[model samples]
Target: MKIYLAPMEGLLDHLLRDMLTRTPGVDICVTEFVRVSGSLLPNRTFQRIAPELLHGSRTPSGVPVRVQLLGSDPACLAENAAKLAELAPMAIDLNFGCPAKTVNRHRGGAVLLDEPELLHEIVSSVRRAVPAAVPVTAKMRLGYNDRTRMLDCAHALTSAGAAELVVHARTKADGYKPPAYWHEIGRIREAVTVPVIANGEIWAVDDYVQCQLESGCDDVMLGRGIVADPGLAARIKGLPAPDWDAIKPLLAAFWDDVLIYILPKYQAGRLKQWLNYLKRIHPEAGIAFEHIKTVKDADVIGAWLAEGCPVPAAEPGWTKA
Candidate 1:
């Protein structure tokens, strides 16, 4: 199975991607979307979002990282893609799955699903702009407000030369709710010729098993699921899973990176955001989060972490969903 790490805007960036891919079983990762509005963005813009481009489009762990672009204007996207291709990314991915309101108001994301023809134009345009060796992929929701045009969108993307597709299995209206409608992904998989990677609502190993059964897709793209449990992908492949003892050092290393890269004011929030997700798997994470939830000083939090911030055994059966 090809397990990909999803591009979570504001949540997963290059630094976090580096740390997460250190574990085995993560094959590839897609960077967060770079909004292409009108003009061709400078090389720095692409490099800023995905510094891995400067390092052969691979993370520190050596996993290839694909750059994702979000926009509606076909010509503009093509121009930006061509300029970005100069940096030699592993691939270029289109973002048709974002559900944010501001993005939709600008006619950028899932809202574009209503017009499959436009999706075709955008994908085909980018495909022509980039080199043949660099693949073009796309991620999309079932639809904008409903699933009426789901298959039409899928067919349009593949026909326009999308190498692969990642379907989130929910409409824009669903908005991160539980029960991600994996059955819908199964239908799309049957309809599309290229590989279909199932996404959405996979939180644990059991969820991954059930998603594979329901979606009938061997490939899966993980977002919050892997972020919450770093050992999730390894567990799926029956590799050794990292316990709390393994996580302690990671937490400290993460804090060090945060201090160096993130602004002093927002550094605390970044660590807390990750810890909030970790709480879902390890109770010890919840304790760590609570201890620093109200503390804003990075040094103070760093001190707490240096003291070996909570490392208790995971609760019995924490490995399962």
Candidate 2:
């Protein structure tokens, strides 16, 4: 099955994408949605979100990165999509799945699910603007406030010429709560002709298996799961998980990459954010997070990481079958 990485707005930026894609089992990485507003965005704007476009649209490890756009305007979304296509992205993904209230209040993200025809118009416009070879895909939740229009939304996207559809199995009201409705994805997959990819709440190899079984989808997307455990994709594929010693270097490498690619002031927060996720899976990560959660200086965090967090020799009970 193909495993794609979800485009988590604040967490899964290009820097993190660079680190995760290098670990293997990640087929494609989508950029955080570039909000297309009143006018067509400039070339620089697209580049800022997806610098991989300049390098064959692939991460350094050669994984393809698709550019994702989020907006409510059909013409404006199409115009920006056309501009992004000019840069030769692996693919263009439309975001109809984001659940942020601020985004929804502005007529973007999951709120658009309430308007199926608008979804069709927006997808159709962009599909027509971009070259046929350049695939245009979309992501969406079950519905805005309920599942009343779930099939309609799925049909709208596919009928509008979307090459693929990714369904995050929850309504806007569900937010990031547990017990993702994986079975609900099966219903949508059965209703849509286009390839359906199931996403949401997949945290481990077992969760991946159960999601595929329940959703009836051959493909799956990883989000916060990957952030919490960098070796999850590998483990899902039956590859050995990276040992703590091996992971320490990757953390350092990520730090180095962030320092070089991002501004100094923003660097510490990024590392802290990643640590917050990591702590869920690694005890050592919890200790590390506590150590640097309050420190705003990137240099101090780097020094702490360089010293290495302590990881136990035995596997945690939660990881066993």
* Residue 227 of model 2, lDDT score: 88
lDDT of 1 by residue, 142-192 (tens): 999999999999999999999999999899999999889999999999998
Candidate 2: tens digits of C-alpha lDDT, residues 1-321 = 888998887779888898888787889889999999999788989898898998999999999999999999999999889889989999999999999999999999999999999999999999999998899999999999999999999999999999999999889999989889999999999998999999999998899989989999879999999989989988888777775566777788899988987887788878878888887988777776676666666655666677775333332321111
TM-score of each: 0.95, 0.93
What is the lDDT of every predicted structure here?
Answer: 0.91, 0.88
Clashes (N, CA, C under 3 Å) per candidate: 0, 0
Best by lDDT: 1
Question: What local lDDT score does residue 130 receive in model 1, on the 0 to 100 scale?
Answer: 89
Model 2 TM-score on a 0 to 1 scale? 0.93
Displacement of the residue 307 alpha carbon in candidate 2, Å:
3.6
Q: TM-score: which candidate is best?
A: 1
Please estimate how well model 1 matches the true structure, expressed as its whole-model Cα lDDT. Answer: 0.91
